[model samples]
Every structure is written in structure tokens, then in C-alpha cells.
Target: MKSSPSARSWIAAGVRHELLTRALPALRHDMAAPVSVIRMALLMLKRQVAAPTVDAAACEERVALIDNQVGELVLAIRSLRDWELATTDDGISRSALVGQCVMLMRSAFDLHGVSLEVDAALDPQEDEHRWPAGAALRYLFLGAMGYLHDGADEAGAIRIEADGANAVRLQAVKRDPGTSPSVLDAHRAPRALAIDAVALQSLADDLGYAVTLDGDSVRLVLATGN
Candidate 1:
């Protein structure tokens, strides 16, 4: 009558796969516009620079804007690559993963007037531990950022810290006392994030991690062994 632990685990993995099928596409869609804009801007900038009569000031402004947009595009692409690696069960360094996530969300945080910080506490010796790459971790990071972005007060800050030796703990805290305590919910997510909170939570559960919301922070504990 009751399902065994192994059976439940199997079911959970299946659910994660299904969620991924939906979530990945949504993520790609969210990223498409930015990528397109960057491509177009680059082409236009190239033509402008090639023109002999280009205005120096106008060229400088366009160059700056292109540089900024390119930076954002690079972050998004890195995050997408990481997610792909994770889905394929590839291995990536913990520091690299966290760094990518932070970079990927940095622009969004800046747009919302939220400060994002990352603290890497692991020793150099611990860098040998390779994290199991997958959408679960990516979802966890993005979901936390989404929650913080929505709930944080103006000029609020988010702190992302990696702690622990054998088992790594990744935490994101919305560091404003005025921030509203909010759990990420699919129904409440903005139209921009097509993936819902339930799918993100499901992926976390399937990956043997729990996303806990305490006050204004979302914490995910990851076991190195997987």
C-alpha cells in the first residue's frame, strides 16, 4: 500500500524530468529577446564604427551601451550553459557555479536597485569537489533571486554565501529589514518568469535538496555526494 523509498525516489526523478521539459523552454524564451537585441546591436555598432563620418560622442555612447548589453548576454549564456551541463549530469566546480549564478542575476538585481554579494568560504583544498551539474541547482538559484527581486525593498541587498566542508550549503538572503517575507509561488510570479515556483520546488525535491524560505532568505543545502 505504501511506496518504498526507492520507488518514491524514482517518481520524484520522473517529476523532475517533466518539470525540466517545461522549464527549460521557458528559460530559453526569457533569454531570447536579450540575445536578439545584443546581436542586432553588435551588427549596428559594427557598421557604425566602419563608417568614416561617425560622430565621436555618439560612437562612444553606442559602444558603452553595447558593452553593457554584451555583459548581460554573456551572463545569461553562461547560466544557460551551466543549466545544460547540469541536466546532462556533467560536473562543474562549486565556485564556478555560484559565480555564474551571481553574474547571471547581477543585471536583474541592479535593475531592481538590489545589491548582490557573494562570499566563498570554502578552502582551496575543497575546490576539488565537483558539483553535480543540473537544472535543479540552477532553478534554486534563480528562484531565490526571483523571490528576492520581487520582495526586496528599494536599495535592498542580497547576500549569497557558500559554507560547509563536505556538504556545501548555498544561501541567499534578502538583507533589508523592510523586505517582505515572501515564498516563491508560481501563481505570483511575474509574466516574465514563465516557470512557476511549484516546478522549481519539485526539481529541488527530486534532486534531494530542499529549498527553505526563512524570513527573507531562501536556503538550499547540497550534499557533495549527490
Candidate 2:
């Protein structure tokens, strides 16, 4: 069994509470804030169960579920946190690389009970788009992500397919009869961002990339020639 402190580190440091709360709602049904506190307490209880050096058979599955839940939470929290702390001067060619975006989106996918696959083939020698320094890049992507998983149901799985040419597509398993892609698009678009969408759009315009939504899918296209 993983220790409680280790799990807490995984929760607070590893995942973004905002993304977890905003992106995925299905997972939150069982995760009450105070209940999470109790679960943390239970981790300690497991160690003292004595004789059962491990957990009881019935508790094994529940423990696994909790661990997975906590892990997903950790990833979501960390992705957004990293974005906030990242500087454009970091000097990496593709400022907000497609791969990094995919990794960041994984937490949201997990929350939606979705799986993600990436097939990026960026030219290693190529340095095309240079992202500007500040909160613009982070917020634009974060806002877009907020919509990607909004109100997504658990009928099937959401698949985010990104090709080598920088074509990113987000498809939920079954159409979210419960929500509209426009709502999410509006949230990610320049006009609707609570943060600085104008600057983000300007940077994206300079990079020759744009975010769009069609029906139940969201697409982000970046240019190799940018």
C-alpha cells in the first residue's frame, strides 16, 4: 500500500483542483472534500489493521479505486500549476509543445473515464512558433481544456487524437446529449475567457494556430511552417 503522505503529495502537488473540479464531474460524485479527508485517515487505518499486513480482500478494490482517483487528481493539479509557473523565456522551441498539451489533458480525460493517444511527429530540428511570456498561453489552453471535458458523460470514452502534422481532435465516446460544444468553445475563445484571451489570441494568431469546435469535438491546429 502507498503511504498517506505520499498520496497527499500526489493529490495536492500532483493534480490541479481547479481542473478536477471544472473538467470532470462524474468522478466528483464520490469525492467529497471532507470525505477525501476521511479517506486520507483511512490510509493510516490500513497500516494498523495488523495480521492483515495488507488490506482485507474486500477492501483491495476500493483502495485501488481511491489510489487511481487520487493519482488523476494529482496530474490535473500539476498540469495547471506548471502552466502558471512556466515562463516563455524557458527557451524550448515549441513554447507550449503539442506533447505537453496532451500530457496536461490526460488528467481531464481520466476524470471523464476517457483514454488519450498521441502521434506527434514534430521536426526535432524545427523551431517554428515562439510563445510569448506570461499567463496568456497558459490561460488560453486552460480555458479550452475546461470546455473539452465539461459535462461529459460515461457512456464510452473520449479519445483525443493528435496527428504528426499538429492536428488535434477531441471526440467524446458518445455525443454529450447533456451539453453543447458551443458553450465550451465560447469559454475557450477570445471573447469569453475570464483571463486574458485577447493576448492569448494574439499570440496564437502570430503562431498561425486556432482553436475550434464542431459538434461534439474540439480541434486545435498548429502550423509546422509557423
Candidate 3:
């Protein structure tokens, strides 16, 4: 059967539209690093320009804004560095990796007067299969809560449980019970949340896990059986 001219035109247009939509995103991502450099240069130019306006408070506010932007840029650079260090070409136990992260946050725990206890005790000689990389976010966020809510005295507690298999959940408790979800989740942006959400999402994306938060409880569920 001969296709109508309008039908043929629609098919051609759809194909071209799909190709451009996909290609444009790829092209933009490839150019992002250079574009970021150009943006930094422009910000520097603004900082160097002669000050025409004379309000001291306004100048201080601009300085604060620039400092915050620089801080975010620095954090992105550090996250890239962490991504490099987190991988091991050879197999490494997931438990050991999580232990290392706990040790790294040990000082923070002490500073906040929080106690950390791990329920998993494996024999040193036992050989368990290594889990996927990037699951350390659960540990990182659990430890961070210890540091963030340390001043809550007897009110703050962090509990982690393994629901058999690959499911894990971390629960943060406050005795006062007045803490709102906003206080716990804190970060309002879709791309930005509390350190816990940020780290959890990163690990979820890498490891194909489902990470979610409900009220004050945060959970990470690994999808694969093996």
C-alpha cells in the first residue's frame, strides 16, 4: 500500500525531531566543561570591574553571593574527586568499604557525642562476594546525621537495619517528636537535598537501587538479587 504524502512527511519529521533532541543533549554535555570555564571567566570579569555603585552593604552581599557560588563549584570538584577514589578495579568487600567510610566520619561522630554501632560482624577469614560500588552513601548520610543533630542531647538517635537480602533502612529519631519533615529533609531543591539525599541518590543511580525518604525515615533498597 502506498503511504499518503502527509503520513510520509509526519514520519520523516518525527525521526528528524528525535535525532535532534537526542543529539543536542549529547552535544551540550560534551561542551559543558568548556562552557563552565567560560562562565567562570565571566564571573571573574564582573568581580574585577570598577565599582560604580557605593553601598557598602550591597558590596558585601555581592561578595557573599560570589563566595557561595565558588563554594558550590568547589563542592562539585570534590565530588568528582571522591568518585575517582571510591572505585576499586579489583574486588573489595562492600562491608569493608562502608567501614572505611565510618572511620572517615569517626571524628565527626566524636565531636557530636554520637555513638556508632555496626551490627554486622563477619569472620575475618570468610570470603563474601563484593557488592556493587557506590553503596557507601547510606553510611555517609547516617554518619552525617550524627554530626548534624549532635546538640539535640538525648533526643537524637540513628538506627540502621538490614531487612534481609539487599534491603537497608536508616532511621533517625528525635525524642522531642516535634521535628518536621522539612527539618529532616532540609534541602528544598529537586537536584539538591540534605547531604543524605544527595549521597543516596548518587549511589542509587550508580548501583541501580531505590532510595526514598518518608517523614524522618530514610531507606535504600537494592534491587538485584545477586
Candidate 4:
């Protein structure tokens, strides 16, 4: 089935943004640090080679440093490659995925003094359908949590509940009355919220999911089949 032009464009933009903002930066930093260290070690070795009398211990230490750096670089590359592979649409456990998302946001919730309650009953082994790839799932969670955290007041609570067989619901209540309207609100489009909302909705759509914002709650519905 062919997708609409706008959908295609949205998917493209979402992928580009994810690559640039998350994956590439992580890869660059992980790879660059070791490369820089290896380069420095090599230059030092070169200098030692030119010296009239090379200190054996110093040369051995330099060689060991270079070896360690190379090992670190290899591990970093492998880890990045594995992460990329995991983002494919191959099925993953729904329960596990949701748990991971919750774990990722736990720290932020603690820092904000907001409590989180998760009532997920979906069985990971029995649920054969995976909502989306790992990275996209993370992106969706990040976007949703970002929206919720911004709206939540100190001591407020966010509840993540699994609604029925195929839907995940995120509800935030007890918000500060004085707090400004949620970014998810159509009328007031704050810059950060606007960008995140668009990205989240677009990515969800591309992944065959539907996101609905009603009051202080957001529900993501997973498609029946791939």
C-alpha cells in the first residue's frame, strides 16, 4: 500500500530528526573520544621512535594505551551497530518496552517530585505484535513524558495504564491550577511542545499507531497487525 505524500514527508522528517538529534550525536561522541586518544598515543609513540634512546617502559606504556583505546573504539562501534539493528520493525515485547520507557523516565519524575504509577497487564510473551522499533518507542516515550512533565505540578502524579488489549494510556492529573495550558492544547503552541508534539504524532502515525490527546491524558493505540 502506498502512503500519502504528506505521510511520507513526515516519516522522512522524523527519521532525519532522530538520526541527527540522538543517534548521530551518540555515535560521534562515543567514536571520537577513543579516536582522539588513539591519535595522541600514536603521536607519542612516533616521538619516542625518533628519540636517540627510547625508554622501553615508556614505549610499552604507550603501546598499551593505544591497545586499550583501540579496544574501546571497537566496542563503541559494535554497541552503536547493535542499537541500529534493534530499531528494525522486528517484534519486541510490549510489556518490556513499556517497562523500559518507564525506567528511562523514572529519574526525571523523581527530580520533579512527581510520582509515577504504571499498571501494565500486557504479557510480553503472549503479545506477538511489537508497536515500533526500540528507538522509535523511546522517542515516543520521551515526547510523551516531556509533555506530561511540563504540565505536571510539583507533587503531581502521572499514571501510565494499559487500556484494553492494544492501547497504552498516559494520564496526568492534579496539575497545578496556576500552571499554563498544556502544550498539547491546540490553541497555545509553545515552541518546544509544538516541535515535540508534531514529531511524536508523525512518528506514531508512521509506526501504525494513533495518538489522541484528551484533556490531560494521551492515549496511544497500536494497530491490529503489521
Q: Which candidate is the best by lDDT?
A: 4
Candidate 4: stretches off by over 4 Å: 1-89, 120-132, 152-155, 175-199, 224-226
Record all residue pairs in model 3 with backbone atoms less than 3 Å apart, i.e. clashing: none
RMSD to native, candidate 1: 7.9
Query: Which is better, 2 or 3, measured by lDDT?
Result: 2
What tens digits encode model 1's per-residue C-alpha lDDT throughout 74-137?
A: 7767755554423576655656556656656665555445667766463234537676654556
**For residues 47-70, what per-residue lDDT tens digits would candidate 2 score against the true structure?**
656545655764666566666767
User: How do the candidates rank by lDDT, highest first?
Assistant: 4, 1, 2, 3
Candidate scoring better on lDDT of 1 and 3: 1
Give the clashing residue pairs of candidate 2, or none: 14-74, 15-73, 15-74, 15-77, 16-76, 16-77
What candidate 1 gets wrong by more than 4 Å, as runs, is 1-81, 85-87, 120-126, 152-155, 166-200, 224-226
Candidate 4 local lDDT, 86-164, one digit each (tens): 3455544567767755665565455455667777464456636665555555555556665566654342678887877
The TM-score obtained by model 4 is 0.52
- TM for every model, in the order presented, reads 0.50, 0.37, 0.40, 0.52
User: Which candidate has the highest TM-score of all?
Assistant: 4
Q: In order, how many clashes per candidate?
A: 2, 6, 0, 0
Model 1's alpha-carbon lDDT is 0.57
Local accuracy by lDDT, each model: 0.57, 0.47, 0.45, 0.63
User: What shift in Å separates residue 218 of candidate 4 from its native position after superposition?
Assistant: 1.0
User: Between 2 and 3, whose TM-score is larger?
Assistant: 3
